[model samples]
Target: MDGQLLTYLFVGISFALYIGIAIWSRAGSTKEFYVAGGGVGPIANGMATAADWMSAASFISMAGIISFMGYDGSVFLMGWTGGYVLLALLLAPYLRKFGKFTVPDFIGDRYYSNTARSVAVFCALIISFTYVAGQMRGVGVVFSRFLEVEIDTGVYIGMIIVLFYAVLGGMKGITYTQVAQYCVLIFAFMVPAIFISIQMTGNPIPMFGMGDTMASNPEVNLLDRLDGLNAELGFDKYTEGSKSMIDVIAITLALMVGTAGLPHVIVRFFTVKRVKDARKSAGYALLFIAILYVTAPAVAVFSRVNLIETVSETDYKEMPAWFTNWEDLGLIGWTDKNADGKIQYLGDGPAMEGDGNKPAFDGVSKGVNGERVIVNPSNSVNELYVDQDIMVMANPEIADLPNWVIALVAAGCLAAALSTAAGLLLVISSSVSHDLIKKMIKPDISEKGELIAARLAAVGAVVIAGYFGINPPGFVAAVVALAFGLAAASFFPAIVLGIFHKRMNKEGAIAGMVVGMGLMLFYMLKFKFHLFGGGTSEDWWFGVSPEGFGAVAMFFNFLVSLVISRFTPAPPLEVQEIVENIRIPSGAGEATH
Candidate 1:
């Protein structure tokens, strides 16, 4: 069968499975809606948690970034995965012991202040909404390709699909749906990698294949060959890095702390039965996530090698069908600067336009005035206009894998996109309904009233998310990275201090959150969005990129909170007792409704 038919078959079946799971696990009460009634098994919850965490960034774009960034790309691998250790060891058990429906719930009750709770609610909304937009953006891209629809229409369809189960089942429905999604997505991610690995290095496992000798040419190491090829094409060495060390360390640290603080991730622990189960759930999540994380580097290696070998200096008229298909979709584009029919991947380099009549991929031209479409190559070497997001999805096609494998990748990308989108929507809905309405606006609202409100909030959040997807603020990778920075700045410090600092008053907590999160947002808006005229790297506080600035903001949060808490009055006696209880293991009982 052709690729589109196979895509329909695989993607259709995956959607069917999710819908079935949602129906079977429809939530009946507010507790069920919010935390799956705190009864989900550790193993099952772990699968859902993995699905929740391994989003479009992880499944679709990460390897692609790694493919081009080379050693500099390891920052994402370390940053995103490292925070799980912090989550498992530091925050998960304590938050699970607190037994709340949302992160704001813990902040409200633990800090014993409606104002702090309100701030937490606002921050959660910002972080979750920003994160969800990236996922929806991914959904739009995949839907546009697989379903043959415009990007906006695809985003609208994605919104409706998420609205169905997320509103119907809440966390209960989302959790089970995510478990099934995890299976489909994981299978989708690995199959192509395994196939390509064996084809290249005679190994079924991608990680091992990354280091093994090439089957096609055993005389040279696969990585060595890639490095030589990269240099020959005027790119940096494949195994070496190009970023400053401080930026790498800073970006990785920010992502790690940001991961630890993400509200959607923290909320998953609330669905389990016991504190121990929460810890185990986190451990299991790390294990499942590791499966993809380890293989991702391998995928990056293969894709980089294959892309360079296939596309560089190849004649435009002889390009593969996938190339033209993507080009027509406006994703890939080219203009021969030297008027040569062959692509020049390194058009922007020092040797271009005059040296040896240096050829160049002069980027996408509008075809206006008979010019070509505009293009953005990964590096100065402009042979490819392939966006970083297309790395993994285009992997099988690049390697000439069968149609079925390409279709399976489509299913996996959807699973990855939809799973995280559902999880983020659940958090958004709960924050508005449970945190804002039920807790703050109508403290006496009935459980039934709260549940209804939650569903309404889910609908509203979907609309907002869809809008942002259609009109994105940044690329998938950049937006997702900013979300991490927001989480790291706003939530991580407050939660960690709330658990450990008995003397931490509401005044201190609120100030820290305001300042820390405020600084991070200011930096992103000024830099990423070009608000307030424009931002320059020269204006960065200490040469930190917007992506790495979150770690700096987090430190400021800790510093501001600790300094202010020293002068402020201590928390109330009851709040102190609550904090103490969360730190222990034995007295933890069922979370109250």
Candidate 2:
């Protein structure tokens, strides 16, 4: 079968599987909806948690980021992996023992204030929406290129699919569906990497292939050859770092703490029957997650090397169908600079003009060489423009992999994106229905009524998520990273203090969250969106990028919480005892009181 037919087959089969699971596991009550009745086995929960954690960012964008940024992208690998360890070791077991349906639920009872819960709910909404936008954008990218639909239409399709499963089955449906998604996505990610590795280096393992010499020329080392090609193109070395040490440290720290604070991932632990299961699931999740994390760098190297070797200085008319297919989607483009018939994929300068480095196509006009014409072509000698997000998706095609492999990858990307989208939408829904409405607005709401409210809220969240996907703030990884910053600045400090500091009071937690969230938002808008008359790198505080500013905001959160807690009345004796009990290693089943 051709790539398109196979793509439909794979994606159709995966979607059918997901919908079937949703139908089979539909929630009947609030307990099933909120926590899957809290009886999930560790292995199944671990697979689900891994799927929930690895979003579009992992399957689609992280490798792509590494392909372009090279060594600078290691921050993503380190920060995210380190953050998961932080969550597993420090947060998951304790949160499970606390027996809350959501993060806001924990904050409310732990701090003895509805006000604290309200603040947490707001933070969760902001972070979840930002993160879901990235997932939806990933969905659109996949559909637009493979399914041959417009990007907006693709997002609409994704919203419908996610809404169906998320609303109908709730956590019960999403959990089991995610387990399947994990298998699909991991297989999808690994198959192409293994194929490319074997093709290039005669090695079956991608990790080994990354270090192996090229099969075509045994004397040339792979990384060394890549570095030579990069040097020839006036780009940074393939294995060298470009970002400053301080900025790297800050970003890594922010992502680590942010992982601990993420509401969606935190709620995963609550889906298990006991605290021990939560810990066990966390360990299992790390093992599952490592399968992808370890292979991403290798995929990056393979994709980048293949892209440059195939396209650079090649005649435009000789380019393959995959190039034009992506060109039609406005993801890959070329201009006839110097009126040469060959593509000049050289230079470190902007490939296209205007904001976001995106190409502004000049109608349907084609250059003398039959390449697309961009209206605002940059002065750079380079004559090619390729979006970073396309690297992983286009890798299989660039390397001339089989049609089935290409199609399988499309299905995998969808799986990775939809799993996380469902998880985030559930967070948004539960925050509204369970946290805001039931806990705060109407404490006496019936379980059936809350379920209805949760489903309705998920529908609304889907609409909003679709809008943001169509008009994304940036690409997938960048947007997701900023969401981590938001989580770190707002929720991390409050949760840590609430658990570890017995004297931490409601006033302090609430104040810390408000201030930290406000600071992070201001920094993100000012630098990322130019909302506050955005300035350049010279204007950054402490020379840290907005992506790393979360650490600074988090510091202030901790300071404010500690200072205010010292000045305020202590928490009631029971709350302090509860904090002490949460740290105990055993007897978690009875700690819920």
TM-score result, candidate 1:
0.95
Clashes of 1: 12
Q: By summed lDDT, which 10 consecutive residues of candidate 1 come out lowest?
A: 351-360
Output the number of the TM-score-best candidate: 2
Report the lDDT tens digits of candidate 1 across residue range 1-593.
87899988998888888888888989999999988888999999999999999999999889987887789889999999999899889998898888886889988988888999999999999999999988998998888876788889989988888888899999999999999999998999999999999999999989999999999988878999999998887778889997777788889999999999999998899888888888889999999999999999999999989978887888877778777666655555666655677777752553221111223344444442232444332335453455677779888998999999999999999899999999999899999999999888998999899999999999999999999889866557778888999999988999999998888888888999999999999998887777877667668778788889899999999999999899989888988998888887774665664
Model 1 misplacement above 4 A: 347-372, 375-383
Candidate 2 lDDT tens digits, 1-593: 77789999999999999999999999998888888988889999999999999999999999998888889899999999999999999888888887786889999999999999999999999999999989999999999999999999999999999999999999999999999999999999999999999999999999999999999999988889999999999888989987889899999898899888999999999888888899999999999999999999999999999999999999999999999998887788888888879988886564441125576786598889788887777888888888888899999999999999999999999999999999999999999999999988998998889999999999999999999989977778988989999999999988888788999999999999999999999999998888889887779988888888888999999999899989999999999999999888874662231
Whole-model lDDT values for every prediction:
0.85, 0.91
Alpha carbon lDDT at 198, candidate 1: 98
Candidate 2 pairs with clashing backbones: none
Quote model 2's TM-score: 0.98
